[model samples]
Target: MPLLHKIAGVVVVCAVVLGLTLPAHRRGAEKESPAGRVGNSSSAAPAAKVSGSPAPSGSPTASATPLKPIPAAAPGAAAVKANELGQIPVLMYHRIVPKPEMSLDRSTKELYDELTRLAKGGYVPITAAEFVSGWINVPAGKHPVVLTFDDSTPGHFALDAAGRPKADTAVAIIQRVAAENPGFRPVATFYLNKELFGMADAQAAAGLRWLVQNGFELGNHTVTHPDLSGMSEDGVHKEIGGMEDRIVQLAGRHTTTFAYPFGAVPRKGKWARKDGSRYSFQGIFLAGWRPSVSPFADEFDRWNIDRVRSEGKIKENDCTKYCSTAWLEYLDKNPDERYTSDGDPNTVTFPKTAEDRLAKEYRRRARTY
Candidate 1:
């Protein structure tokens, strides 16, 4: 193969291999439970608060629904008035490695400590559906945070020297924290590609089944975890729709949520694909991929919501920084502020001059994978 072809081939092979092995090795729950079923919404609009009004009494409810709207405060009142339009931050993670050598991963101990801090600090870790549904209403003082893990890496469930699934370590951490903190039952969503779930590994399959059986929800990241913005419509369907099918098969539930691989969204370019199969400008808009500084638009696709990446070793203090209470507070006050632009996922109106530079950086980083 030519040098370029060789590199492309390698990329394709790696993607296939990683896709196939990870899910097979770390399978969890597949059965649907009340927790998994309650908050699942195919549409994102249902998740937003409606003009500071309580949802109709018959509207679907979740176990941890957001608090009902209180009367608007008097002008200049002492209370810090809650912004009814606040955007919920969906925090993302790739790995939780134990050693500095594995910087992307957080150690077992570190993961536990971080969860503990979140609980004590009053951060409610909710599933994507819950966040989207505006489910699990908490008081204005209690902010909602969505915890997500991407890639479905082996380390997420790898065995220690003693030969036990490493996921147990993370689960144990959550269990302990939940035990001590009664009201801090944090739920997490795991986005996995079909290739990640091994058809041959019974143990891994069981692990995934267990995840769904428990309170955790499974989300579709993509069948191959590719950058959809650059692919053909068929490619996008294979990546998005294919993964959704696989997740439903493996997890025994239909998955409506999606997380973009490398978080890339389509730009305002012409679509070369045939009509009827072309990308929907409206669908893209509903996907919530826009410049961060635009006025907040409530329309969104629960499947392709935005996320904030969490990195480095997971420490309790790091959680404070990663979760950024200040940032959450800012969003709380300025609910109308957008996080990404409709024209391009990478563009942001703030610090306006750097948009091109930032977009270039994003593209370069994405090309590596």
Candidate 2:
């Protein structure tokens, strides 16, 4: 070979060797949006996927994997007759007291018994955030239920001497029931007020952090639990935004969901969903009598989600038909009407007959068997 050709060949070989041996350049991290600040929409809307790790103080920390179409065999859908478009019971509780003193109060034993029944019936607990995000990741043949506690009462959460959950509290009872029943998730969403579970500032902070660390979600229930329907837009914003700031200060996690104080949306309904970006609730719940439609259902409204009261079949309390007891029994009798998981989070599976009931946006994730 000529000297020039030999030099060219050696240069080519050196370039190839360098390309093979050099380490790949690291890609810069993508800038993420502030967590839990999903768009405010009346209808069910697509929320940005949140990062899993906790953000800094006064910021939000949550995670949700956006669903995508995966055209795979859904064996569990047909065998379980899974109905992704069916009703989901987002049961609401106010006070888990030692004794039932009022219509809204549930005794400790009653709460435990109800949870036990839910566990036995193959119901898995998911947070309000997950429900509103349409992230129902339950196992096959399991039903997703949202166990939400409002008011952040002392009975809702507290710590014992050794930092364990105190006995007779809702947290302790839920943990106990979950331990007894295999696969029963102890997770729940506690909508907090300014009171912070009636604990001192330090204790409250510890309790709030513990709940979040242990898979529980903290939500906004306004600074003062007021009848929002009668409040002005400014008043509503103050209450909601004030609560959001307080939650971030105390829990260090932004709230992803909100529950109306008295199930009352403002005269202008949009105020319930947002307040100038101080807080943006992906899901806003009402104190409802019946179970709500699936998040992916055509009629589902993220801003006006329904939540059933925690009561038995008592005519005096006017819960004979629509309360949790009657509703749970009704679902048991009519299993096909309840939301059953297809065991795949990425795909939303339902019967062919219910195909039309699904939201059009979710068609990509829809799997009809």
Candidate 3:
């Protein structure tokens, strides 16, 4: 057999093995629970955030073997902002390993550069919960950016004994950059499936707790990361609800955001939920080529929230179609269209033309920046 074919076969097998052996997380509430919260561990060493080991990579582009047709975008040659014309660029990532392993995977250096660029550009990370609530509340004069790491790969994050993000890991890189830049924030959302970062029960539980306790956010990415369009409502419920249950167990909190698996949804509609599940997400994510509009924007669609895949090197990833890197370039070339911070957290600001269309009732302190 050809060597390339053998390599592809190996990749497939590794994916399957990882999927089947991943420890379980979501079950009904009464099933069982871990021994204790993260702080209950025997170590008395105070949890002072420190640094950890070296590892990190980029988003998982492995599933979309072909550039599957993405959701229909807003009509126009120029990128249009959703509701009241407010746009927020959300960067999507997958496996953030120490070195790049695939087209979708990027190294720690790459992740660091991308994040630092945002920080330097006056961007601040915001939680999906905040986005859904229409309360951005990022520092005044800082544009809001959402960093989403899908798949929950082990390479994405790992901590040292001191509870710090170790070297080269995505979390560490993010924290390092945030610490170095006064206005940047160390916040992100992780969308997980059956495998929580390649860790077993206790380790997985700690990883989840570290995220919530440390000001990060978590979301449901379904149980096994299946194509939702093919499944019945019951199956979808099991997939989403089950994952939500597990995340609550591991993270000690419930998530109100979700990322569609394979970017597939049941009807290409606006929202979905498995009844009786502990979660009812207000923001549902779609695999992307651009950012989302403000939740309060007139065009905001809870059904198809958009996200841009991380990595600015568009040519290498067929970036024009594969991700949102082009928009970064576009923003560079067209600075005015970009979302610039107005130095106020109580109000939502955008181009003057959008003022008339603003949802007035939602604004307590409405004014131009």
Candidate 4:
């Protein structure tokens, strides 16, 4: 009787082990993991030596997907309103260079420090897509930031010899910062003009794919980087629509944001328009001298969104006119007006005195502390 019981137990155990192991192996084969596909993104793009990079390429895939909207608990609460209300600063940068002759041109070290400062200050980088869709749902007490690079310079992106992104570019710095900081995310928006990464066609295409696959974002800065104030209606359409087409061709997705060139748009409502030929963008970013209001603020408008230029006071130049320093200083002077996270992302919290000024959408889920 004992021998028969032992034999039956062994057979049962063997069947259980096979059931557990076979499904895991099958699951592994079902989908292409991020680790395997990310490495080969630069293989199609030939290496080019550029001043900005080892330096240049092209956009969004990452393991930690962006916070999608939660279903609304109240009637009339749109999905976007499900996002907690908080202040978000979208920083605009250009030329992540090794050496900086101009104040606008930031060195890699400076970029690293800025990212570090944000991470240490309880800030998380959100993509431009997240900003536009109003899906920013970062953990409680963490502020959302958007690091946007205009001009698609070589220093913004570059690939190493082994078909991997170089670690010193802005993209690499963002990713590296996220790796070191537990809750920080590596994401930024790159606004493209021609010759992104100094690669013409094929390499540029590859670079764009890499950016998209790695969870970074791409936006339209126009094909020729023209000032829209001087252009006619048809010209404005061409400047934006054309770039959108090329970016889609490379990334296999629609680019939903547009940044104005030289901080200028042709008309008030004219910043965003789609002819029969193209997809209309949801966000239009302005060149800002200050941080923007909350995406859900009563004053906030998607088409006329603002982005603070990334520049600290370098040498003798005061960059506050076009940089974010001005707004930071203002907040320092009047801290009460500044939006601060109260460490609970599930429910929106702000000052009781500030309640009357909040957007209608925010008031629903809001709790004033």
Q: State which candidate has the highest lDDT.
A: 2
Q: Which stretches of candidate 3 lie over 4 Å from their true place?
A: 1-85, 268-271, 320-324, 360-365
User: What does candidate 1's lDDT look like per residue over 1-369, in tens digits?
Assistant: 689999999999998887777743244423332221222222322333333344565667521245332332333221323232235566666665565355445666766766776677556666765554434445334445667777776545444456434554454456567878887764687777654533344554666777767677676677677776787766676566666555555666765355667767544222311124222112111222111221122233333455554443246435434543444545545544413112112211222222222221122211100
Cα RMSDs, all models: 21.3, 15.7, 22.9, 22.2
Q: TM-score winner among the candidates? A: 2
Better of 2 and 4 by lDDT: 2
Clashes of 2: 0
lDDT of 2 by residue, 42-113 (tens): 221223332233334444423323554436437767788878888999999999999989889999999999
The TM-score obtained by model 2 is: 0.81
Those runs of model 4 whose alpha carbons end farther than 4 Å from true positions after fitting are 1-86, 314-322, 325-335, 342-347
Residue pairs clashing, model 2? none
What is candidate 3's CA lDDT for residue 307? 85
lDDT of 4 by residue, 214-249 (tens): 888888888999888878788888888888888888
291-355 in candidate 3: lDDT tens per residue? 77666554566657888888764676467744655666676566565555444455555544565
TM-score of each: 0.54, 0.81, 0.72, 0.71
> Model 4 reaches what TM-score against the true structure?
0.71
lDDT of candidate 3 at residue 329, scale 0 to 100: 66
Cα lDDT computed for each candidate against the true fold: 0.48, 0.86, 0.69, 0.69
